[model samples]
Target chain A: MNQTTETSPRPLSARIGGGILLTAAIAIAVEASTFEVAFLTDPVGPKALPLLVAAILAAGGLAQLFRPDIDVAWPESAVLTRMAGAAGSFVGYAVVLPYVGFFLSTTAVVTALSLLYGGPPLKGTLAAAALSGALWLLFVSVLGLPLPIGDLWMR
Target chain B: MDALTHLISGFAIALQPLNLGLAFVGVFVGTFVGMLPGIGPINAIAILIPVTFAAGLPPESALILLTGIYYGSQYGNSISTILLNVPGTASAVVTAIDGHAMTKAGRGGPALAMSAIASFFGGTVSIFALVLFAPVLAGWAIRFGPAEYFALMVFAFSALSSFSGGSLMRGLAATAFGLFLATVGLDPNSAIPRFTFGSLQLLDGMDFVVVTIGLFAVSEVIQLLEDTEGGQAAAVGYGRVMISAKEFAETGWTMVRGSVIGFLVGVLPGAGGTIASFLAYSTEERINGANGTFGEGDIRGVAAPEAANNAAANGAMIPLLTLGVPGSGTTAVLLGAMLGLGVTPGPLLITEQPDLFWGLAASMYIGNIFLLMLNLPLVGFFVKALTLPRWFLIPGVAALAFVAVYAVNGSSFDLVMMTGFGVVGYLMRKFSFPLAPVILGLVLGPLMEKSLRRAMALSGGDWRILFDSPIAITLWVLALASLLAPALIARKGVPAE
Candidate 1:
């Protein structure tokens, strides 16, 4: 549906994605080549699948590079910033989870995401806290799966 | 008679309190998530995989719950399509054309009722067909040697790549990336690690759960964020979810035809519900010719695609259960869950795990009944849930995803990796790459590699063994044909899209 006319230039994003894929294929092939084995355990060995994958990736990358798609609708900068913020919170939650404990870190991340999605601060925090407590009860108390107690609290 | 007897015994398992309760939960949750935008059954199943594992349910019970979600979502997807004009998944896309048109004409209630009935009809028909055909297919598949299995996997990869609704090259690339990820961790044949990069965490390879959640659920979250403008609130009142007898008469034959078409298409690798529904809709349109209101809110229009997709969902289970090769993304995830539950689905699965096989079949019947009841009398409740603010709903889904990803191995590092994948998945979506092929390749790659190496080992490194057998050759031909057919169709100017 988003076909480009023959005269129109291809989207830069498509070409960039193609180049990256091509580079990845080369990297995969190079890494696969180094996989040496002293004994013949199987006729194909470990490298076959990866090499095959590399070849497929190379073919796809070349095709994309030569003939790129017409249009790719990237999000606006503001939307991108929100996405980055959400991604940042996810990474931060993982990094600090062991120290901050599941309840606190989960609440923080959810609240952060809620704000990004445009919730009122008080309502978002309340909902985040409620969700965090519910998850803790379900996973830790009921399911018997351990959630980190936070070294900060344990200490 | 043998299948019937086994099915009866399966009802005993399906009727058990725990299994029955799980089936209900699965369908209920499936409907809720499926009706909602941005959280399709794939995300729901992926997020629940770790939770299901943690709960320690038996393999059959876990499967009943998971498969209930699979088909239940098919029924639920139509609700949003009819109500909000938002088709939840690709399969539901065709439904919106007529479904939303009916809603605009104040016939939304009848449309919803028609969707429920048609879904029920389609689901039951396909399940019956599944029971009849699966055992027969399994009986034949049991004779497949390693070479045949290798060819079958290749066919799956090729068919999925070709039919995944984009350029074949992009689909192939996605499949290759998934295969590359599968090659990470320890090489089972050799003691060497191929792509671990010296990390202890990489030794286990990519946990399909983490990868799936990241690719589907988390990426969905970021993608949803792209459209920060809140969606239009669904209209609260539909007179009542009921269809007149005249309407049913108009749609009865349509449903039967749709179910048959859907089941056949669904049995093929990669075709799945989207194509099945499209084919069914076009067929009905052609049949109606000048006499049909078709896209302008005809009841048959609503019935056709809904019936076809629901039937296709069940039809997909045949290949997954019999051959242990899933044709679509959702079924592929189900296969991953089955493996995680210690159930190896193959030709022997029916004989060895009758309860798992037959019980699943029986529970589908119950799940369909539950979906009907939920969609009909309680349709208002789900529509009400549509009005919930995005801030509360989306964050809630994100939180659930985080817990699910974290629960997989209980390591925070996986959470980080999930974020990385989420970003990658977002880019892939932006670039028009298909995500299903990636999951298919990741799930099937190891088995594909194992079958290939085993075939070669048996033949003492003879490359020709891959094409030596008739079955293998047939499968190879099918794979090649699937790849080439699309190109040929496009050349004919028939508008394959």
Candidate 2:
């Protein structure tokens, strides 16, 4: 039950403001290009929307840059590192999935993530392998998801 | 009487063996997911939508199941609130106040029973309200033009921003962010690429499901990692799921009053369950006065808020189904689902698609009955699931999410995109921006832009026509007022984040 409170006595506020400004700037830039591309198409095409969105984003970004509020708590660096690892593992699963096959890669990635998330080493590894294999069977074998069954294994 | 006739026909459709079964499944699974800490109704619906599409179920049946879960979770959310003191949705927060007190007082079983009864009463009453009000609103909405639609969308964003909690600027910023994401992909009208950034996948624009899963599910995983100690609730120790007759007598009127007040409040923009429950509970307290036990395990306390929350849930649907505008994160996800299903909900919806409208309305009644029956007798089964180990549960969910993303296009590339968005979602949560508005913007942005352009085209590019109709003017005024009024009220100091 994480309550959405702004005035908690925490030091994560300025950091959040900086992040918002950065994200908003990027959003505005990306949307501005959308506006340009829309104009290049038909005069009344989807360009108007991107342009409108971009303007709003730019305004929000400027507001954040000028007056960023402080109202968040930064988790410990270790926690962030583990989260980063989890993200990386998923990305890795996606990249190596087709080539290495669903079972092996999914097992590897899930285990790696579980370990990073503080699962006991033995339990994490076993749980990841079993969970990944079970998922493959359910979605692929039962539900028919067309998952890659590993060319290496087939060969 | 008219509603009864349509409802009878709807029952005929809902009772069809296939739809009836799907309704059961929807409520069952919805209750399970809703009971699980961190996994709310929205996530459950989004993740399962792809499965329904793959199953190729008929639209009504698909909707029956999904919408069943939507209402069913209203009953289930209270379980955690009463048993574990964890309110999965904002509505359940009120339930936890009196419910936890009852649990501590060793009347947990009675409290749980009262919640189920209150939820059922509120849901039944609200469904009646929906049937009576929806058609009336739809009839009047038939005359709405594109300008009016655009104004309505503005009202939606303005309302959400004002009520999104913490910071108005942050909420506006989140909405703006969502609109930007919506702009990604080929221009629907011109067939020209806009913001594809040379990536082919970008041509289809960002999928709402992908964003939803990332923002709600994956980000939840990241948040949980920060607190690796799993949720541990105090065990329930009540003797039986039976409320005293005296308790029922005291709470019956409170439940009725809460339903009426909550339904009305929920109909307004920017008034979410938080406001609805607060108003209902406070009103009940005031009405009861000295005779009423306002806080010390008052049965009415449980009934009032529980009824109001459920009614507010149904009330929130008015704008979503009839006006294509959502007042909260959960309804925003629903709007996304409708769009994904190729169902455009707007003023013309009722007239153009009576079956979808009336069928959905009828199915809601079925869903409510199913939810009550499911929660009442089968409570023990749901509580057993609470013992599931986090190791198995968390990884299983992640794997399912992976499959869902892959199912979207049957591509690993989508998984990559999902992971990236997951990171972005986690960051957004880490920051203080509201995620619901982003989903709202992404879903509604294209439609809003389309309406704006169409309005201009019809008016020969005359901007003044945007303010022509009284309805449209009123909507615009409300939208502006929603944005400015909150800031004016909180003149103490602006939120920093």
Candidate 3:
């Protein structure tokens, strides 16, 4: 039985997608189970939409589970690296934004992404800096939109 | 006559210097952004919403600018489709077929010119239709109760889900996820928290600007990076930008027919430019089958889809202006922008904000004129943009997207959420899930919930009140019909023209 389990292979992504969805459905249903209103805002309360969403999700998930398998075409390893690196840069930009401010963080991220996109490093840096500077002038200086000037720099 | 008077005043407002300048900038930017391969109309409009808001322009001006981006995109969409054989937006997919064929045949210039002319024809003709039909629909929709609004929104969700993507189940899942996201903030009625998981940042709910930029723009950047190894495109110069007089006369009727077909389909709850262009091209082919070259480098081939798609873009506005419901993903984002601008679009919208409605209608005509002027002499200039390296183009857009998302709340938390949503969006796109329905579900979810609850409360907890009215019943029927529509369309094999 253990050998068969090892040989059965991981289920199709349909099953995994379905499993994740089903998990969300059960979680929402359980969470809605705990929703208590002090006064009935309405007879149905705020529970109705969430319940309806859970129902739709469960139906879709169940259909995927029972339906014929469809495999996800995962990106190749090299391509995966590029995608991960690009996505990570965006997340990293968000974390560093408060500490380093808009212009520096934006310029750095853009330059790295530009280089990854295969531009020459020096040209990419110049272009990234110009674009970031222009956007900062537009947003902060001209448009008067408040952007963080970096807490570290302030201190 | 009443419409004429309204239109005249609309022109008066649109002609104002600031509004006119904004309109021009909108179309110009719309064209420039739409010329980029991965950046379509939805991304262009989504990326600009925060900027327009941060600038503190009037709601009407913002609407004008955004809508200009909406329709002007059709004019620009054909450029890349013809040049690269890669449609910039989904609606231009059909345009790519005969358009690229024309380019390969060395008739790219004539094909582009025909597309521009057809787009202009579709744009001008549909503005008149919008001017005529919007008021009528608004007047009729004034009688809708809360129950009816809920049913109508359901119809919209079903329609977009069924039409926009490959599988019905995937679209619905994306929609369910969007509705779940919509439920993240405080429960409006009882003032209870939901799905927030004890974070103050989630309390005010997901901002559409942040969500949209993350979904449309950020996902696009990731998608582009997956294929970064491709070499640069060789510059394809469209030789000359003039359609022969004889060719224009030949395809004149083709343009008119496509415009009419596109306009009517676009007004329907779920149908947008994709179906409209397909229907228009197939119909024109059938009509011209006697001696015509459709799949070849036929000028009429380029004319039909271009005309249909542009007309459909304008036609989609009718429901939005009249009933306050947007039919497609792009318009759903527009609806969110309008809501953020504090403009509640509904039956009272025309009467209450006549300036907004009429001025938008007027500016569209003016925008179309500018589009023709811009696309005609400057085809070479725009096509040269196709040669721009991905590294330069992709990162610039990503930076713009980052700024837009950050500008929304001035919080790094929103930026993190935006990045998370970007990853989610990237996964969704890979899985062939339709992103539009998700946006529609999020933007309309609260309103649908509110209406459902209000109706239930009004009827003292009887859920049957949702189906009690004839109008609500009709809408419920439409919703069910649209859900069954794709299967039926597939069964019939995409309709024989």
User: Taking the tens digit of each residue's C-alpha lDDT, what string does model 1 give over B142-207?
Assistant: 999999999998898888888887788888898898889888998888878979999999998999
TM-score of every model versus the real structure: 0.97, 0.91, 0.96
User: DockQ for all models, in order?
Assistant: 0.57, 0.44, 0.46
Q: Which tens-of-lDDT digit does each residue in B1-497 have in candidate 3?
A: 89999999999999999888888889888888877777788888888888899989998888888887876666666787887776766778889888889888888999999999999999888999999988999999999999999999999988888888587777787788888889888888888999888989999988887888888788888877767744345787567989999999999999999999999999986648988899889999899977887888788888998898889988998888889899988889899999999999999999998998899899989989888888898888887776888888889888888888888888888777887888888878755677888888889989988898899889988889999989999998998988888888789877411
- Candidate 3: stretches off by over 4 Å: A1-11, A69-71, B230-232, B495-497
**lDDT score at residue B239, model 2, on the 0-100 scale:** 49
Instruction: Please report, as a residue range, the 10-residue window in candidate 2 chain B with the lowest summed lDDT.
Output: B488-497
lDDT of 3 at A72: 59
| Model 2, span B1-497: residue lDDT tens | 87678777777888888888888888887888777777777777778777766666767777787787787666667887787777876667777888888877888788888988887888789988988898788778888899998999899888887777667767887887788788788877667777787899889989988888888778877777776655654346754877889889888899999899889978877746767787788788788858865676777888998888888888988888888877777888787777767787776777687777777877787777887787778877776666565655676678778878777787888888888777778777766667778888888888888888788778767788789999999999999998887677568563311
CAPRI-style quality class for the chain A–B interface of candidate 2: acceptable
The lowest-lDDT stretch of 10 consecutive residues in candidate 3 chain B is B224-233
TM-score of 2: 0.91
TM-score of predicted chain A against the true chain A, for each candidate: 0.91, 0.73, 0.85
